[model samples]
Target: MRIALAQINPVVGDLLGNADRIHAALAATEVNGKVSADLLVTPELSLWGYPPRDLLFSAAHLEQQQQALDQLQQRLHAEQLDVALLVGVAEVAPDQQHPRLFNALALVQARGWQVVARKQLLPSYDVFDETRYFRASSSPSTLSLRVNNRDWQLGLSICEDLWVDEELHGQRLVGPDPIASLIPERLDALINCSASPFSRRKGTLRHELAARAAERLQCPVVYVNQVGGNDELIFDGASFVIAPGDDTPLLQLPEFAVSTEVWTAASSTDRLEQPSRAHQQANTPDDDLEALFRGLVTGVKDYATKCGFKAALLGLSGGIDSALVAVIAAAALGPDHVQSLLMPSPWSSSGSIADALALATRLGIASQIVPIQTLMEGFEATLTPALNAEPSGITAENLQSRIRGTLLMAMANQQGQLLLSTGNKSELAVGYCTLYGDMNGGLAVIGDLYKSTVFALCHWLDSPDAGACRAELGLGGSGPLIGQAILEKPPSAELRPDQKDSDSLPDYERLDPLLMDLIEQRMSGEQLIGAGHDPDDVKRIERLFRRAEFKRRQAPPLLKVSKQAFGSGWRLPIAAI
Candidate 1:
């Protein structure tokens, strides 16, 4: 059977727009007034986009989805297309229950569309609240298709349905195994439509899951994923098809982009052979750094574009974090559209200022120097009367950061640009960053990346391995984009004289691992100590992390790139110990 995987990017709540995208995909995959493939599949909830959240609660939104599906059917019939299209939709439950919706797939032909498959495993973990929005299906869904004078039994599964291996995930969802259910059906091929978000090395896990399912069913497995950024979630559509018994994929789609390609499976009577090593090498998974860079670029670009902003503004402090954000902004929105303000305070080193300017020059992005020394004196003068003393120590230091943040926001507002926050995960985790100061922006570009990860990504960006990626991202020049000076310089806020991050917090080399354990692994102080972390250091870091909940709660939404990020996934009580 010939199947076309439509790896598409859908805008949330833009029902007609998404349908138009599907229509365009159909047109692109056609040959002389007929679709070349026997079936076309789109990602989960392709009609409404993924994680519509509260948008699902609106009756008008659901009605609009039905209208969009009707329009797509009409277009297909009007165009005389002869292919069965599998598009994701939210099926209204007939029983009119509390949730009243099922995350489902609709089989669209020229005449009309019908809901064929409903998702069974509704994930409620980490950034996903599927249980709150959708009711699970009790049984597996299967479809019998007649193509090319032959019968094919196709198994249908949604995003989380294929993730049933306990060994791979360390734990399994408590429900019927979708893969095991299909084993009794003797399926010809399995298709998983998903809107899985991007996380480091998640593509590997996806491949393993698909490969295992294919092996168990003794058939080929096709995985199609949604691509683009929706709010804090960024979906990396690394869609692929894996033949049974082979861990390597026979066909692989590009990551972090929209693509549609047709894959032809061998007849049921014949065995599906694995692809040659040369082909396998060509379709190998991307380097983690490359995926990380592309994911951030996609997040920034989509967030700005979807939110109706053409330009971006950020405070470029010569520090590595800000420097990386500047580069990402330039790549996402063209360098011409990304502007930066070098808000140098009295404590800002001349070398740092020069380095910031040089890096901006290399990137071809516009930069402006906004000195804040005069503003600092004005603030002290204004507040001294009420306090009977000048703001000193941490208060004075935070004043500098706030001053810079205010300038960036003003410029962004005046120019109608999106403001990008440059704080990294480590600073945000330990409350090393100032709330309403460095945390001020429409989106936090690197808030999910640890300090160590930020440094590593920068180093990779400078290396030759990133050449192809840089070219694809339209980053100019072959020379190092981030200078050695910025990479080698110690991390500092520059709010105080010679302010080093290490002065208040442990070294990032030690702190990031502990933070990862505490946050992502959810390790307690005792567990951390048992794992060989210093008891005193663990206690101090844990206290800091817990105390920073209030600040994180007030911070702007950050792009999610890790398994756990501070955005929607990290749920903790602010009043707790």
Candidate 2:
């Protein structure tokens, strides 16, 4: 059997557009003509979107979905396409006696459509509220189709259905051995339509799980996923097919883009197109740079596109964070649309101005040199005498940042561009950044990325593979725009003279791993200390992390690239300590 995985990104409510995308996918593969497959699989909720959330309650949305499905069925019949389309949607059980809707898959056959049962498990933990909207089904859904003169029996499952064994938030959430029920009756394949979110090292984990399932089921498994960004979520579309008997994937599709690949048992010749390896390599300079750059570009484009903004503006401080944000802005919005404001202060050095101009010139974006020294003087005049004998420390330094922040916001307001915040995860975690100062922006690009990761990404962008075309056309030069100096220079805030980030915070070499353990792995301070991390360092970092919650609460909505991000997923009290 040759099946096509239609990896698609659909807007949350546009049923027509979603159906159109599904039609386009069907036409591309000509599911009935060249390749005779029993089924064509699409991502979960391909019609109404993965998690329609509160929108599911509206009668209008549900009516539109039914109408769209009717139209889809009519179109399929009109085209005389004999292939069975297994698609995910918000299914309303005829019995409407059921209180909630079901996260469902409906198999549209040549004759008519039938409900292939709703999800047995409705996930309700962190970032998911499936239980709030969807009601669980009692039995497995089995469907039969005739393909290539043979009857093909198949089973359907949605995103969270396959992971029955996994405990979510310390609670076991699903039935035991959901896949085992299908074993009693012979089945050709298991098609899972998913809308899984992206996270570092998640792909490897998914692959392992899929392989294990395939081995247990003794049938080929087709995994189709949604792509593109929806609100704070980004769906990485590295869909693949696993052969039952073999460990290697039979077919693989690329990530963060729309792609299609066919998988067949009899066909000995098949090629694999994998997702970008930039995220997989943590230590490699080139790959890390490409990953971070791509992540930022996606972040900028999606945040602007989804939020209805066209242009981006940022403060260029001649530092790596600002430089990286500038490059990402250029890539996302065209150079004509990306505006850089050089907010040099009285404390700012000449070398900073020189480097900022050099970068702006290389990138060919509009640049404005705004001297914030006057603004700093005005702030000092206002605050000096009010302070009796308090030492001038972080408060004084923050005044400079606030001045620059005001100037950047002024530019963004004048030019109608969204200001991109340049503070990274490391600084944000420890409250190293100033609220309403460096923290002011519409979207926080690379806010989820660590400081050390930012350096690695800069180095990668300077390498050869950085030659990949800018996501937007007619913006960047053919090759990389990052300079060797930007990649090699020591990272600093430049808020104070001769201040390096290392002066206060732990070295990134030590910092990022500890953060990964603490945040991503959810390890306690004692656990980190037990795992060879210094106890004092862990204690300090933990303290900083706990204290910074209030600042993060005020921070703009951040683009999430990790499993546990400071954004919506990692919700905690401001004073947890």
Candidate 3:
């Protein structure tokens, strides 16, 4: 059987657009003679896009989806494409008693399209809320196709269906073993369609799961995933195939980009003797940071592009957070399309402005210096009558950020550019960010990156290995693109005189580790203190973290690069103690 994996990027709620994307890919491969395969597979919910969330509940959305599938089948038939393509869909179960929709896979051939598979193992934990939208399938879905006068049976699973290794997890997740059930029936290949979100080092987990399923079934596993950003969730389309008992992947697709590749396999009687080379091999540990950077860039680009913004602008403070955002934006939207505003207040150091300019120059991006001092004085003067006193202390400090935020917003609105927010995890975790001030952006580019990881990524960008990535992204400068000044300087809001972040929060070196334990590991305050974290600081940070829930709820959607980001997955009650 010859199979093609379409690792695609689909925007949520864009059913017609997603169908068009699938058609375009199929046509491109046909024209280039690269998709002359028996079967084609796309990611989960490729028609309506993944993480449709509440959009699935809308009868109108479901109606659009059905129309899209009809249109897709008509196009495929009209074009006379002979390839059998398995595209994901959202199907309304005929039985009205069940959940309205079943996350399904439809097999589209030249004649028509049919729902061949429905997803089981609906994961409600973490970022996934499929239970609210999709009904879990009670039985396995298998498809038999006759090619070259031989019958081939393919086991079909979607996303969480193949992730049923309870033994590895130390406990069961209260689900039937989808993979094990397929083993008894005997299959040619197991194809899994996934819209799996990206997290740091998540590729390993995927590889293990696929490999394990292949081992259990003694069949080749084809895993195709959605690639791109949908809100805060980033789908790292590191799609691959694993032969039975193979420790390493047979064919690994590229990460952070759309990829389509064809793999030809014999029937079960004649299995592949050796593993096939990956279409795009995984450069594992070495390229982890590169992958993360690429993921963020893709997220920003997709978010901006899909949201209908061609250009992006951000408030480029001389701080590391904004600098990183600028770099990411420049890479994502291109230097010509990305703009920056150095909104320096009177308290802002001269070097801060200079550093922002240097970064802009290094990135070859357009920027303007918009001083907030005048605006600050005017705001204070205007608000004095309403306040009954001068806007002083933290109020005065946050005013500067608001002024800059407002200026950036004005620039974005007038110029029609998406504004990028530049706050890090450390600041967001402890409520150090000013709401409606520096937190104003169409998308929070680095909201998931801890302060330390931001520094490390920047350092990695300056390293020799980053040349290819920098060049690929159209970044210039033979020397450090981020520069030593911006990197070596202590992080600060620069809203007030000598306003170092250290004054309010612990140094990133200490803060990030404690944060990882508390947020990602979900350690209790006592557990955190027991793990050698400072007790008072732990208590203080805990209080701050809890208090900041309201702010986070109001903040712009942030890019999720970590395991436990403050976006969709972090569902802490704001009114809780």
Which of the numbered candidates is closest to the native, going by highest TM-score? Answer: 1
Candidate 3: worst-modelled 10 consecutive residues by lDDT: 277-286
For model 1, residues 338-367, the per-residue Cα lDDT tens digits are 898998888999989999999999998999
TM value for model 3? 0.96
Question: Which lDDT tens digits does candidate 3 get at residues 1-577?
Answer: 6788888899899899998888776755553664476788899999888888888888888888888888888876786766788989888878886577888999988788889999878888878888888888899999999887888999999988988886664344577889988988788899999999998888888888888889889889999999999888888898888888777777788888887777776678767575456354664334889989999998998888888999999888777888888899988998999898887788989998899998899888998987777888899999999999999999998888888888889989999999899998888888998888988988988899999999999998888888888887888635688989988999888777888889989888999999999998999999999999999889999999999999999889998988789888888888998
User: Comparing candidate 1 with candidate 3, which one achieves the higher lDDT?
Assistant: 1
Residue 267 CA displacement from its true place in model 3, Å: 1.9
Q: Is candidate 2 or candidate 3 better by TM-score?
A: 3
Candidate 1: give the clashing pairs. none
Candidates sorted on lDDT, descending: 1, 3, 2
**Per-residue lDDT of model 2, residues 190-300, tens digit only:** 777899887666676677667666766766667899987776677777888776656656677777777655555332122122312211212211243455455557667
TM-score of each: 0.98, 0.88, 0.96
Query: What stretches of model 3 exceed 4 Å from their correct place?
Result: 31-35, 167-172, 272-286, 385-388
lDDT, candidates in the order shown: 0.90, 0.75, 0.86
Worst lDDT run of 10 residues, candidate 1, spans: 275-284
**In lDDT terms, how accurate is model 2?**
0.75
Candidate 1 achieves a global lDDT of: 0.90
- Residue 447: error of model 3 in Å? 0.4
Q: Residue 483 error for model 3, in Å?
A: 0.2
Candidate 1 — which residues are off by over 4 angstroms?
A: 32-34, 273-285
